[model samples]
Target: MRATVIRAPHDIRVEEVADAVVREPADAVVRVLRACICGSDLWAYRGESARQPGQRIGHEFLGVVEGTGADVTGFAPGDLVVAPFVWSDGTCEYCAEGLQTSCPRGGFWGSAGSDGGQGEAVRVPFADGTLVKLPADAASDDRLLTGLLALSDVLGTGHHAAVGAGVAPGSTVAVVGDGAVGLCGVLAARRLGADRIIALGRHTARTDIARLFGATDVVAARGEEAVAAVREMTGGHGAQAVIEAVGTEQSMRTAVGIARDGGAIGYVGVPHGSGTGLDLSVMFDRNIALRGGVAPVRAYIPELLPDVLDGTIDPSPVFDLAVPLGGVPGGYKAMDERTALKVLVTP
Candidate 1:
C-alpha cells in the first residue's frame, strides 16, 4: 500500500507502506473510498507545526468495511462508513457527554504508529465507536458522496462553531474566515436559521461560495477596518454571534472586535503562533462570552449527517480540486499556494 508522508517543509510524497489490517479486537480495516485534505494540515506543510521526516499525513476519510476484528459488531464487510479525524471509545464518559475528542483512549489518525486517511486503506481503532455507517447508495452519487465526506470534518466543525456561538432563529452572525471551514460556517449559520450572516474575507472566489451558502453580506477587509464594516452593517451593535474560523492572532482580534456586547464568539480555528489575541479585560467589561476550541466533530456527525444526505446543505462545493493518490504532492502544493480551496483524494 502507498500513503502520503511528510518528508519536510514544502515536501509531501506518496510512498509504499505496510498494508492496513485489524490489529485489535476493537479494530476494523477499511478500504478508503473518499478522503480529503484539511486546512489544519497546512500548518505542518508550512513547517509551522513540527513533524518527523516520513510521518504519515491526512486525517479525514470514508470507506467500506474490508474486515473487522471479532469484537466489532456494528459493521460487517461491504458496509459503507466514515471515520472521524480522531478515534474514540464510544463508552467513555466524555463520549457520553458528546465530547468524543476527550475520550480517555481516543487518538488522532496520522499520529506516530497509526495509519493515515490519505491511503488506500486504514486500520481504525475502536471501530464501532469511531466509524459511522453510511447509506450504501451514497457510493454511486459523486456529489452526495462528497457531501457525506464533509461530515467527516469541515462541516461538523462549522456546525460546532454555530452551536458554540448560540446561533438561532433570526440571529445575526458573522464569520471571520473564508477558507473551507469559514464557508461551511456560513452554511451552518443558515442551517441554524440565522437571518443575517456577515462573512469576512478578501477572496472573491471564496466569498462567492459564502453567498451561495447564505452569507447576507461580505466584508472583504482585515484588522479594525473589517471590524468597523461589520459594526456599521449592524448599526453599531456588532453581530450577536461570531464564528472565528481563522486561527490567528489578527482574526481572533477581529472576532472580538466585531462581537456585540454580551454576545458570544465561537472559535473553531486551530490556534497557531505565539499569541492568542485574547483580551480578558475587554470581554469582562462588555460581558461578552467566549466559547469553542478544537471541535468535537465526532459528536456532531449524527446530527449533521441527515442534512447532508437530504441535500439540505451541500458542502461539496468546498472541494475545488480532486487528485488521485499519486497526485497528492501536487494537491498539497495547490492548497499551500491558495490555488485550491480543498482537495478531494480518490484512492
Candidate 2:
C-alpha cells in the first residue's frame, strides 16, 4: 500500500508502505476511497507542529470496510463508512457526554502508531465507535462524496465552533477567516437559524463560497477595520457570537473584539504564531465566554450526515481540486500556497 509521509516541512511524499491489517479485536481495516488535506495539517507542513522526520500525515477520510476484528460488530466487510479524525471507545464517560475528543482511550489518526488517513488503507482502532456507516445507496456523485468527507472534520469542527459560541436562532454571528472551516462555520450558523452571518476573509473566491454557504455579509477588511465593520453590522453592539477559525493571535483578537460584551467566541483554529497572551482583563470586563478545542467530530457526524446525504446543505465546494494518492505532495502545496480551498485525495 502507498501512503503519504512528511520527511520535513514542505516535503511531502507518497511512498509504498506496509499494508494495513487488523491488530486488535476492536479494530478494522478500511480501504480509503477519499481523503483530504486539513488546515491543521499545515501546522506540521509549515514546521510549526512537532512531528518526526518520516511521520505519516493526514486525518480526514472515508472508505469501504475491508476487514474487521472479531470484536467489531457495528460494521462488516464491504460497508461504506466515514472515520472521525479521532478514534475513541464509545463507552467512555467523556464520549457519553459528547466529548469523544477527550476520551481517555481516544487518540488522533496518524498518531500513536495509527496509519494516516491519506493512504490506501488504514487500521481503525475502536472501529465500532469511530466509523459511521453510510447508507447503502449513498450517492456516487463527487459533490456528495466531497460533502461526506467534510463531515469527518471541517464541517464537524465548524459546527463545534458555532455551538461553542452559543449561536442561536435570530442571533447575529460573525466568523473570522475564510478557510474551509470558516466557510463551513457560515453554513453551520445558517443551519442553526442565525439571522445574520458576517464572514471575514480577504480572498474573493473564499468569501464567495462563504456567502453561498449562508454568509449574510462578507468583510474583506482586516484588524481594527474588520472589527469595526462587524461592529457596525451589528449596530455598534458587535456580533452576538463569533467563530474564530484562523487560530492565530490576530484572528483571536479580532474574534474577541467583534463579539458583544456578553457574547461568546468559539475558537477552532489550532492556535499558532508567537506565544500570545489572552487578555483576561478584556474578557472579564466584557463578560465574554470563550470555548473551543479539538472538535469531537464523531459526536457531530450523525447530526450532519443526513443533511449532506439529502443535499439540503452541500459543502463539496470546499474541495476546489482533487488529486490521486500519488499526487498528495502537490495537494499539500496547493493548500499551503492558498491556491486551493481544500484538496481532496482519491486513493
Quick one: best TM-score, which candidate?
1
Worst 10 residues of 2 by lDDT: 136-145
Per-residue C-alpha lDDT of model 1 across residues 1-347, encoded as one tens digit per residue: 99999999989999999999999999999999999999999998999999889989999999999999999999999999999889999998999998999998998888888988899999999999999999999999999999999988899889888988889999999999999999999999999999999999999989999999999999999999999999999999999999999899999999999999999999899999899898879989988888998778889898999999999999999999999999899999999999999999999
Error of 2 at 313 (Å): 1.1
How close is every model to the real structure, measured as TM-score? 0.99, 0.98
Candidate 2's residue-wise lDDT over 1-347, tens digit each? 99998888999889898999999999999999899999999999999998888788999999999999999999999998998999999998999988999989998887847799999999999999889999866637667877899998999999999999999999999999899999999999999999999999999999999999999899999989999998888889999899999988998888888999999999899988885436779989999989988899899999999999998889999899999998899998999999999999999
Candidate 2 residues lying further than 4 Å off, grouped into runs, are none
Clashing pairs counted in every model: 0, 0
